[model samples]
Target: MGSDFYQQSILPFAGIIIKICRAYTHSQEDFEDYYQEVCLQIWRSRDNFNAESKWSTWIYKVALNVCLTHLKQRKKGEQQFVSDALPDEVHDDAKAFGSDELNLLYNAIKHLSEIDRAVILLYLEEKSYAEIGEIIGANTNSIGVRITRIKERLNKFIQAQE
Candidate 1:
């Protein structure tokens, strides 16, 4: 992809990566490392971008892989991050949605199996079922059914908070 396309199409998803970081990291520092790693992974994979899947779908996979790699290395006693940094676009809306109600949502998302969480997040983001299936490497016919169950489970978790 051209630099202009990356600046436009890929850059807009920075917030999504930040949101994913917020869900996965416990501190500002770790989040920064995870976010940067995700971007780097996406950059490395750009040459291989296949039009078969939506850009967002491909990004979600790369972001998750970056987090999982960092988390694994962290478990091995690596110093995964050295700083807490915030990009200019990260703002109050992300922090606002991260409130108690959405913290519950984030926590609920965490409870899902890795691939399940990927599927559900894309679903919530309103990606087509076909796109989600392509992203998760699952059957399109089954994604809708899995998403329905995911919503039901999330509803249960949210209600139990009451």
Candidate 2:
């Protein structure tokens, strides 16, 4: 019984939740707190899931909603993390991402307003425009336009870094 649910449910979505939390929250403690909160939310909400969409889609909605609400409370200004002192695991992820691209991504993301980052994060994870809109309470057509500009702006931001 113990291994059954883990094998069926938790294992599949854990990495996605972790990555979403990481992308949304810069502070380590907050990230862990929110990640756990998301897990609890998932467990509680699982029964309500109707499966009209894929399981991944439902999980994304719940997890992203949790992150957005949490991120909305953060301060306005962006906080920069100096690469040198980052812990080995995070440091390795950054390094493996390649300095140039990773720096561009971090700079681009850090520059986004909290909500915009949430939009872009879900979009990047390949959520459909309708799903993105539903998650953020926008129309699908509008979200499609916003995503295009967001990608362009992200590119410009990367260029600014270079």
Candidate 2 per-residue C-alpha lDDT over 9-123 given as tens digits, one digit per residue, 9 for 90 to 100: 7556765676677777766666666666676678778889898877877777788788777666455553222222332334344345346666468558867876677789888
Q: For residues 1-162, what per-residue lDDT tens digits would candidate 1 score against the true structure?
A: 366755776678976787676667767678777876787678878878887767777788788777777777887988745554655555544566656777788888877766677778788778898888776788999999999998888889778876
The lDDT of model 1 is: 0.75
| Candidate 2 wrong stretches, greater than 4 Å | 1-3, 73-100
Q: What is residue 48's positional error in candidate 2, in angstroms? A: 1.7
Report how far residue 155 has shifted in candidate 1, in Å.
Answer: 1.7
Q: In candidate 2, how many clashes are counted? A: 0
Candidate 1: residue pairs that collide: none
Question: What are the root-mean-square deviations of the candidates from the true structure over C-alphas?
Answer: 2.9, 5.9
Worst 10 residues of 2 by lDDT: 79-88
